[model samples]
Target: MENITFNHIYTLGNIVFENEIYKHYHYPEMLVRYDSNFLAFKKMPSIDEFKAAFTYLRNYHMKHGQSHVKFTFPENQKPPEGFLEYLNDNDFLYGYNELYEIQPDQFPRLKDNPDININPVTAENLDAFLTLQYTFDEEYGEEFAKQKVALHNRNFKDEQIMQVLAYYRGLPAGSVDIIISEDTAEIDQLSVLDTMQRKGIGGRLQKFVMDHFPQKTIILVADGNDTPREMYQKQNYQYVGFKYECIKVFE
Candidate 1:
């Protein structure tokens, strides 16, 4: 098998993003996902080009009813000189995300529980899946929750996305959505209820998915400042790289 490269990961990530966003603009210097109000550069550009890119993105998004927008620069790509200064001068909120990947051999196997069952979500249990998904979004505020609801409404029908649900002793405990590409499996939106955390539910759900794609590389992105990154580290996921993001949410 060929070794998985960052470029492969980058391309797959954009595929996933495009599906969720629905519309996009692919420019030589950057790719923009419209409905999500997001953009990312393939590589750094000259200061004049960078400024023009920003102006183009802002104008396009604003015309489309998105007042606020976000841009991400992958660590694998060179950051243009003065990129940070530009963000600061514009008063954009900034953050980073850690990208992790793993192979089957490195996947951890947790103790099996006869009481726990993880299964692919089907139409029969679709409502149950939505309940947990919406519950997970509650903390993020109503607007975020609404956005998630809309995303999932579209995502559930996408053939590339595999939805899994975990039941603990006959009750829904957690769920995950895996985005499948030709050679890689990217886990998107893995969530476990607060009351279900630390009971091995999350690990079992992850392992269940890993078992399905033994020959493919698994990928996920974690917030650089979040505890989930620590949990992923414990699962033996390699930190390949990260991307810094600049976001401005219009009031």
Candidate 2:
């Protein structure tokens, strides 16, 4: 497999600015989605450069009534000297994301459960899908949930995007959005209801992807600090690379 970089990851946001140092992505419709709006640095910068970039993103987000500033550093690159300490001192939350990919043959075959039925989101099941998404998004807040539903509504019309809901015994219990390209199927927003976890619903969802797109490479980004990455590894997904990111949220 070729080396994977952050540039290979799929994103729905539009790039608003790009230069030698960094690129800015913005999706005004989904202000609360950190992945949709962020500054991605191409290289580690001096403290002064970091501050300038932070100020620019902070002011840009504030102008749009957004309360967060996010920055993604170059993939597989260590931060500049004192950068982590600087972020900690300034109350910035920092983490990294591990990118993983798996071929169809590498993915394990999951046992099919009669109780679990996965379906593509369409007119007939859109409400159930939205309900499941809203239930998850509501953790952030009602307003954020509403906005996310609207964004999903827009995404539903896109030909490259496919949202699926996993029903456990006739109830929507898990959901994921797949962004398809010619050679890849990127899985995003995969979640299972807390009440229905540990029942193999998550693996079933991945099996759905494998069954549907057997020829394309399946990829996803996982929080480097989270347990889900461990699950991915156990499921035979290859860890490709990681990118560091930090964010500050205003009250």
Candidate 3:
């Protein structure tokens, strides 16, 4: 986060977490976030320090107790060959993958199903949305959701978070956050919790947004292998580009 222009919610600054060992950021729900490419640590690491660094990361996740925190290292800063093994030893479900950007038209045509009833994420339904988000993560990205919620609850704004918690039939089923930067509207952080999957909730949620916003270009990040890619492709979204998930070494 150093040398970058952004509104940081982390008082420890956009550097490391309070303990100094775990480096992270509190991303607003709708806004796209990226590391400044500024190294979280001072230098490339020696093998001896790898254990301690991974330990710190593990503790960092435990301390925060929820939500997945991502540390982006430069593509050139390689970890020791056994680094991922170290993470596995600590029960970290680590997977390296691509972040694909899909366009709206590519997503499926809405069944326009009657099973779904979409609504705004107001303060009255925040807890439901949060709970729904938890269930969603548990089903699809349980561990990742834990870290994400933990970090999100502690470090993000109530209103901003609500913006990502739109309701469906009085239950928190899914959400798509909207952000206006300069002249463009960025659609992001869309999530449909578990128990609601395949219920047409996601399509309904987004379709409602499109109904209100027909001319806007919706944007977001999805795992290259996530099944949601099929959904996005059905939404008429073209693959504009991609963002790499590189390793961020803090040594």
Candidate 4:
């Protein structure tokens, strides 16, 4: 696996500000996506600097009708001394994400399943794809789901993106979006229905990517504290790096 830094991670947003310290990304179209609207540090800041930065982010997001503030640290760096304690004292929810990558051949052979079928999203299956995604997005709210569906519709027209849905017994059970680049394909937003868990739907969806992108490295970011990272390790994905991030939501 290559040195998969934050550059390999894709987001649907534009950078609104930048300095030696950090960059601010804002996507007014999707306020629900915290990943698309936040600050990313280029290096660690002192607690006083962090307080000022958080204040700035909090005000910026509030002015835009957002209810949260988020910040991501540079990859492969541990939090500066007292940073986690500062976040904890300030009521921010914090965690890190583990980046994993596997070459096509590195992926182990998965058991063949006759009942599960995977297909790329096309005009014929676009509605099914959107419906399945909306089910997952609706947890935030109906308006957020509608906005996400609109975003997905826009993504469908982009040549660099491929969205796929997994079917079990002819019903949409899971889906994932593949962001294509010259030498890598990153899997984003991989999801399976609550009723469909533990039936290998997620693995089948991943296998679909591995088979289709045999020449490119397949990459994904898993919650470092979550069980899925363990599964990724068991599936032979190499853990490349991690980044610490935290978010605070206001009422």
Scored by lDDT, the top model is 4
| Pairs that clash in candidate 1 | none
* Candidate 1 lDDT over residue span 65-147, tens digit each: 55666666656554554777777887887777778889977988788789889989888998888888889887866666766
**Global CA lDDT computed for model 3:** 0.48
Ten-residue stretch with the least lDDT total in model 1: 12-21
Clashing pairs in 4: none
Q: Which stretches of candidate 2 lie over 4 Å from their true place?
A: none
Ranking by lDDT: 4, 2, 1, 3
- Give one digit per residue, the lDDT tens place, for model 2 in 1-251: 45555566787689999888889999977888888899989888778988999999999998999999999888898786588999999999998899999997888877768999999999999998999899999999999899998998998999999999999999999999998987888899999999999999999888889989999889999999999999999999999999899999999
* Model 2 vs. true fold: TM: 0.97
Please give, for residues 57-173, the per-residue lDDT of candidate 3 as tens digits: 546544544234344333224455576565556554434323323234444555555556766556566566667666655654465567557645543354333255545465566
Better of 1 and 2 by TM-score: 2
Once superposed on the true structure, which residue ranges of model 1 sit more than 4 Å away at CA? Answer: 1-35, 77-81
lDDT of model 1 at position 96: 77
